[model samples]
Target: ATLPGEQLFEQFTKGLELVFGDKPSLGFICGIKEAVREDGATLPGLCCIDAPYQLDEDYWGSEYQCEVDDGLGSLIPNPCERISPYFGKISEESCKVYGGTYCPLTDCTRLQECVAELIDIARNENRTAFANYLLNAPNITDPENSFQCGWAREYFGFPANFINDNQICEDIKQFRNSRDFEFLEEFFNQGSSSDEPGDDDDNFNVVPPLVLVPPDPENRDATEAVSKKAEVQNGQAWRATNFALESAAKTLNSIYDAIKDSKCPCGGPFCVAGDICKLVQNIAQKITVVGLILIETSAEISKFTYGEVAELGNVEPIQTGERVKAIYDNMVLTGNYLQRRFQGVNDYLERMENRLVRALAPPSAPGPAPETVASPSNPNITFVVRNGVGCDGLDQDGDSVEDNCEEDRFPPSLRLTSKASTSFVCEVDYCLEERFRTQTEAITFLNAVFDVVDDCSAPEFVQKVIEQIPGTVCEKTRFEIIPVQTFPENSTCADVTLPGISAIVELGLDTSAPTVLCGFQVDRSDDDRRVSPDSKTLVIPSERKSSFVDTLLFQTTADNCPGPLRRMVTVQSNEFVYGTNSVVLINQENTEDGSVVPRLFVNPQSCADGSQDDATICDPDPVSDFRFYEVKISVTDAVGNEAVDTCRVIVEPSRRRNLAKQTKDSQRSSSESGKGSKKIIPIEELLLKVAESNVRYTLATVTSEVSPSPVA
Candidate 1:
């Protein structure tokens, strides 16, 4: 017979295959077995054995009844009777030995009770044991069983079961070595021991060893070494790759530099090395062939050419190719190319080399020639002036001699004549007699004479002579005289005249012929005399008039008059005199001697004294100078030329010492008469009284005339 534990274990294994598949790991499968074992009694329990065969009614008595007992007494039977009853019955002695003296039925009842109690104990103990087992279980490694039976999988749906077998064990080992697991185990064990009922030292009980595993030092060392080697290998690979790239770049740079620096026989540095070398070789071959040809041709040309035409005038022939090549070689070595053509090289180099050769070579010499000097061979004709004569002199007729015969005459003559043979004589008296080839020469001679005597200073006679010479004189030749005149003192007059007087006096001018006098007067004065009060001469105070003269003189020239001739005249009166009985006419021309014949006459009867006095008094001429005698003279020329002249005489007061004296007796008589004349009124008072009397008489006359006739 199978034990319940074993049967349940089998059932769980089968269920796991159906639910989770595969044989689970031992730890998790064990946990599942324990859970099932604890709950085994609760799952509807199965019978241990099948039921017995049922009895048929044919084999039983017709009246047989199926009675059943409520307890084990009915299920068990008595076996003491020896009557050979049915095969199912047992004797009483057999019942006592097999079931006990209580009978089979009672024994059977007791056995059933014991089995139920054992089942109850097994379930309760298994549940507690299963929980403990799972808490302490090792990690499961099987995928299916771990997923189906682990606490996390069972309660939640965590697929801890999905962890690979090796990884699960690794984690489990890591957890076991952790301090947390160790602490948990120690703490739980101590608590379990403390809960023991009768143990005094249980609190101090030693905890079981926790299953914490220590790390494997050998594996750790192996892992570190492997990781370090991998990192170093990777670094080395990167460095090697970078170095390879750098080397490649350097190689490329060198190639570029070589190409850039290389010179090509062609124009530029664009060709590769192989191309440049080929070009150089080909050029050399061509140059060699050209040099040979040039040399042969040059020899032939030299044989035929010679002299100046070949050397200078003609273009020189270029040598053939071979000769040119030979020259190029020689020039490359010694640098000379006088007779060669340049080709197959750098263009600039060819040009430069040619220029150098030309510069270094000597120049060619010139051919021969002739020389002479030039001069003139004829003498120029010249003319000379005789006397004042020149080429322009007049001859009146076509004859060359001047017509007029004066002692200082300029004899006309002709030296050079024009080829036209036309001759004419100058008719002018002062003409130049010498002939001139050019008018400019004649003009130059005349200008010299003009410089000596210009028109403004030349004499008028000389100007007239020049003007009357027909066309012989230059129009610009004329004479002018500037008169500078000064007038005589007191000779100027305005409204009066004197015999033998001219309006304008000629000075330093030609008076041999009549001429008009015209010019402005400067600094003129009308007074006859100028007085300096500081001098002893008495000044006659009077208003006088005078003017400048611009006049014409008939039949006379300015030379007849003296230098600084008087052009005007003035008349003036003497100063006032005082205390004279009568004004006298002294000499008007000589005031100091008073001896001139009087030109003025006045009757003394016309004066207040009615006396014929010869002197004037200040009382008679108080308004001005006391010249009482005035003479007015009328002049008539012998040819009926008429004019007037006036003279004045002044008589001044007598000195006080020259007065008549009175006698002493006469003075006494006059004093007495003055005393007796008190009754007589003074003349001024008598005049006043007479004026008042006249005024009253006139008033009475006016009143009577104005009033009505009294009682007519």
Candidate 2:
């Protein structure tokens, strides 16, 4: 930045002096030079010393014209049309790092200052004085001897990377590279160049200052406290373990003293074996004591200060810490030793017990098994399993193992079978049974229908009937209408767990970006166990089997399910109900990428039974005895606020065949002669009461004056 009347001519000349090392070098920039007289027309100075100095030399203007008159036009003509040839004649000592000096060393910084000062001088003060000197400037004796320079373009922040290999750009790069100036370090450390394509004017990308927090005062002793507590636990655990081992050893010795003298059946030579056999029973009892000790010791350790920690309170902290570590190492060894010893003693006892039990037990008898003919009508066609009845210690039923330790031949499994009457393979069982009411005198027998859904994720609508008895009902039931919920309860932001239904929002796919799929957590009461959000086992049955959007895989987020509980469950995002009136389970899992991905428990398995290799998810030929499912549940809160509710779910006829609707249709049809529910209506029952009163009056009249009292 130049200013008015700042002596710009001498300043830029001084920059040339430093670059060329005090030598009288030719001007590197055409635009700035002291003017002088021409060769043929000299005044006082050799070229143009008496003329005013100029800061800007327009190649097309009088300054260049004067240069031509002075016979310097051949060397410095029209710099815009062709850069000054002096650009290719940079001094060997100039700063040369690359093709251009966009941000050169401090030497170039000072030169730029000089050039900038003259720019202002040309505009505000002594403009003509500078202009006169610029024209008719003396030509250099050797154009190749001009000082190399680039400060003007770099200081002005013009792009130095011209995208071409021009001579001026090449000269600037070489001049800057030739220097090893430490003063240029600041420019190199800058994050970006001013001429970069996307650099912002404000340079907002500069590094921010760091912040640090002072350590907490309490934290100074926190590590020592934790270490001390762990030491106390170790000491307590060691002492308890030792006591258990000592007690076991004492009991074994006492038993050995008693058993060695009495057992003498093999006194000839193998009597020692008899004595060892006698010790087997006592050893088994001692092993049980060791197992009990392990459980009790672990339970004691969890009792806070009352347990092992209390026992270690009097010990010195340093000594206790070292002893704790030593005891911990020894505990592992002791545990392994006792376990191996127990196994040996238990094995010997088992062999002796097996021999004695087998000798006393009678010959084994096999029980009769019910025969099955593989009839589809038989609900119990599947095999039944029961534990075998054999001598307690010996192997039975030809398997090479003790009966008590026999391995079950079969695992618990399910098989889908078909019914005989309907050749269609049964995927689900639906049964209804009728019963006449006997206990209730006021109510008549009616078929009560109960429609129910088992899964809560996507509920199937069911219609149920209650007897409507004139008494206090014992049960209350409520099914949540909305399972996938996302709503705040108050002015403050709340966890996404609203009881009301969730508002539906439009969903779109962003295939341009990939994301993890996840869903929201269900609102369960605090006591209710939460199924892992990661391995979401819930299902929302849908009518169509389509993509994620179509499959209804959207829910609000929940915080309880974090870490491993929050997982990325990926599978088919389609819901395949396929239009059968059966259960629908759309297993959608919450994934990490904030997307809902559907997971399948059974894939390539059709809901339709008997489809080839189809693993059906329903019971075949299941006998569900339809009775009124009545249960009473009492809910008592912490404050003893109690509520008792009894719910009775029974099957009811469809709405079209409802009792009230049937009665209405019957009454309407009666005007044209027709039928309906024979159950007594209020109006008909009243009319029948009046008719019976009249009949009683007539009978009284036939019996003479005995009918005098009006049948009220």
Candidate 3:
């Protein structure tokens, strides 16, 4: 549970200065209100703390007075004063007692800007790591936006509420009762968070405020009762979350059932509904898994028989926060996708309904019959074809010419081709006869537009572009995203060198990408050959972290390209093969040159956890006779040109931990050979001893019984 934004920041900032022994030069999350982002989606509250605002020290400090103006508990300073500027290096006074240094962040504005950039980068992943960095960053000018420092928490005292029973003195309790503690109970003690969260979302989520008031040490019963109550409450909340997740899963299954049971003329495995059901099932299963993880993580926070909130301690409140964040993020993504899908389904159903309504309509009495010609289309009514782009085999442009003419080539640079043209507008309109039946439609035309379809048929971008297009005749619009591939000419796969580090490094990406008339292909390699399940190379989707090929970067030089795709280096190794995360022997002799005019790539696969799976390939320790692997890199340009090359990877090797232990064992064996060593005892002797002991035990039992009778 957390307090409102303003109150949360106040407490957090107070903890920093009051507990951590500093003048508090950070934390300016002032305004808490809903903010809309550029994408038109309304997110959480915006915290424009970096922007200049009138500092209201009196408002927060209020009449609630404290005995001392000291520590993080000191009055909130002016907006500018919230940050202290320093330059050059960390001063000795700024260093931690045990010795940790931080470059003073004197320029508050610059620091905030840098921090914001970091937060943006983290929005997609691992925000906790960035938060930890900001919590204890060194004072330094962040021109490049990289701030990292290590310091022990011991350097700063725990917050007043965070301190244990022994640490809280009567004087401190009295001071807290009179001052800062008032706000923790009443959220703001003044105002609440903004209901409309903006683009600059600052976790405006409302949670139960902390009920912090030191218990009477002498009143043991009251303390135990409070502790028990808290334990039960926390457990209840956790259990409720689990129950909600189960309910959601059941609901999704129910939805899938409805979709499955729906009538469809076509029948194969699951008809048209199977794909949707599969997607929903995947999301439901994952949601359940993440929910279970969230519950388990929250439960592990305390093993206390009763309860305690003495300090943050090993209690990873951040993890709990992140788990919620992950859940929300996944749920949002899945919900959005499902919504779009259902919307498409609704549109199709609506079209069908309109058709049926038209079919059943009453005819006009004694209308004049117009002269009609026996044409392929319905000649009863005059029809003029509208102009539009086309890729499918039909005169979509309304020109007398058939499929050969692609009137408005999109990607304007895409040329007409005999086969595999990937240039089509997101949506286009053309006049058609009422007699036209959807069943007569080609697989690509019907499947690609307004229906869940294959990538080649519809592609990912078509729907996006189509949605953005306005003022279109809804009945005639056709959507498709096509990127045509042309044969490559004079193309060369450049020799590239990548940084050999545990960190992800891009291979000479800027210079090494395939250069052709059209765009190129870049993919991860495996076994000295280009990584491709089919003839077409896999296109890298997004930037990812890896020791080797993170993604295959594909670019089309045609008039239309979907912006630049970022690439991350995949850690290549030989040992961590076949998805096994274990130390294993390397095949030193399996070296092959896959340079057939076609390039070989050394694309190594990674474990789900993003670690190099092959322990033998990239061993970190020094060992003699290191083995190298080859990878084939190949690219087929937008124009039918193809180029391939082979690259070698020098995988670092390590002697397994067993080597040192084995050496010690050998030395001990040699030493023991000269000294007296015990011989191995046979099992027959042990069996005889066991038999003798059993007989003695029987005799003793009888004697004891007889002796006991003497008392009687």
Q: What is the TM-score of each candidate against the true structure?
A: 0.13, 0.12, 0.19
- Each prediction's RMSD over C-alphas, in Å, is 69.1, 46.5, 41.8
Give the per-residue lDDT digits (tens) of candidate 3, residues 269-355: 223222322332343334334433432333333222113332221222332333333232222212222233334434444433333
Q: Put down candidate 2 lDDT per residue, 572-662, tens digits, no spaces.
A: 2111333232212343434454443332222222222222123323222122111111222232221122233322221111221244346
What tens-digit string does per-residue lDDT give for candidate 1 at 626-653? 2222223332211122233322222222
User: Sorted on TM-score, highest at the top, how do the candidates line up?
Assistant: 3, 1, 2
The clash count for each model shown is 53, 43, 55
User: How far in Å is the alpha carbon of 382 misplaced in model 2?
Assistant: 50
Best by lDDT: 3
Residue 263 local lDDT, model 3: 27
Would you list the C-alpha lDDT of every candidate in the order shown?
0.25, 0.25, 0.26
